[model samples]
Target: MQLIQLNLKHCRAAQDLLMQTVRERGSEVAILSEPYRTGNSQGWATDRTGKAALWLCGIGAQQMCDIKAADGFVRANVCGTWLYSCYLASSLSLESFGRILDELSIDLRGHCNAVVGGDFNAWAIE
Candidate 1:
C-alpha cells in the first residue's frame, strides 16, 4: 500500500531508479513522467504528454499481478491554455482537449483502481 509520486523529467536513469525503489520497498505501485511526449513504441511507455506512471503488485500477490498491470495506470492530458511559442501557431484547440478528457474519463473508469497520475496541466487557482 505504498505510493510514490515522481516527476521523471524524461530521463532514462529515472526508470532505473524506479526499479530500484520497487526492489527495496517491495513497492507494487509507482508513477513516472515521460516528459518528451514519446509513445511507448519509442522505447518508453508514456502518456500523451510524454509522462507515464506505473503500479506493481507487491510480493505474494501473484494473482493480482497476473491481472493487467495497465489497469492500475492512468494518463491525463494536462496541456491547457498555456501555449508555448512553438505551439502558438498550431491549430490545436483547448476546447477540443477538454472534450477529450470528458470522453476519456468514461472509458478509463472501467480499466483500473481509482488512482490518477500524470501531467494534469491544471493550475492551482483553476
Candidate 2:
C-alpha cells in the first residue's frame, strides 16, 4: 500500500495541492496534519480516497502536547490499519520532536509497521 504524508499550512492552495498530489500518485492511503479542520468541515472531504485519515494537531501549546501524546509514532504497525492519529505542534524543535517520537516508540512498543502516513514535524537522519 502507498502512504502519502503531508503537513498542510491550512491554506486552500495547500489543500488543493495535497489533493492533486494524492490524485496524481493514486495513493491508496493518505495522512494529513494541521491546516485541516475537524468535524463537518471541508477539510475532512480532502480524504477523497475514504482510505485517507486526518490528524489535526490542535493549535498553539495544545498542539505541542498533542504531538508528544500521540500513540502512532511508528508506521510499521500502523500501516494498512484504519486507525488514524493526529498531533498538532505550535513550534517545531528537535528536542520537542524527538520527545514525541520517543513517546510514540513507547506507545507502539517497537512496532513499526502499522502506521500509514501523517505529518511528523521532525527531521531525522537515518
Candidate 3:
C-alpha cells in the first residue's frame, strides 16, 4: 500500500499542499500529526486531542482490521499490518512520555509487521 506521513503543523496551506501532493502521487493513505482542524476531517481516524490523524482511501479503508485513537496517537491495522501516527510534544514531562511509550509498546508487542512515523519533537537542544 502507498502511504505518506507528514506533520501539518496546523497550517491550512500545508494541508492543501499535502492533499494535492497525495492526489498527484496516488497515495492511498496519509498519516499526519498536528493537523489543521478547520480543514476536511470527515472520515479520518483522529486522536482524542486531535493531535494525530490518518486518512484511508479506497483499498486502504477496506483493508482496515482495527483502529484505535488516543490523546497523542492514532493507529490503524491495514492489510494485516499496523500503522501508527504519533505526536510526542517536547513540552511533556519525561515521566509522561515514558508512560505513553510503555503503553504503546505493550500494544505493539503483539504485532510484528508495523510502521511508525511522526514528529516526536526529539530534536536536540545543542
TM per candidate: 0.49, 0.48, 0.86
Candidate 2 residue spans exceeding 4 A from truth? 38-99, 110-112, 116-126
Error of 1 at 11 (Å): 0.5
Report the C-alpha lDDT of model 1 over 61-80, residue by residue, as the tens digit.
32112212222134422211
Task: Rank by TM-score, highest first.
Answer: 3, 1, 2
- Residue 106 displacement (Å), model 2: 1.2
Predicted candidate 3 versus true structure: per-residue lDDT over 1-126, tens digit per residue: 888999999999999898788888888878899988633544478767788887774344455547888767878887777988898898988777878788778778877889888888865657
Best by lDDT: 3
Residues 1-126, candidate 2: write the lDDT tens digits: 555677665667887776677778766444665544434531232232222245322221211111122332322122224434444253647676667666655665543344535555454559
Candidate 3, residue 81: Cα displacement in angstroms equals 1.7
lDDT of each: 0.41, 0.45, 0.79
Kindly report which residue stretches of model 3 are placed more than 4 angstroms away from their true locations once superposed. 38-42, 58-63, 123-126
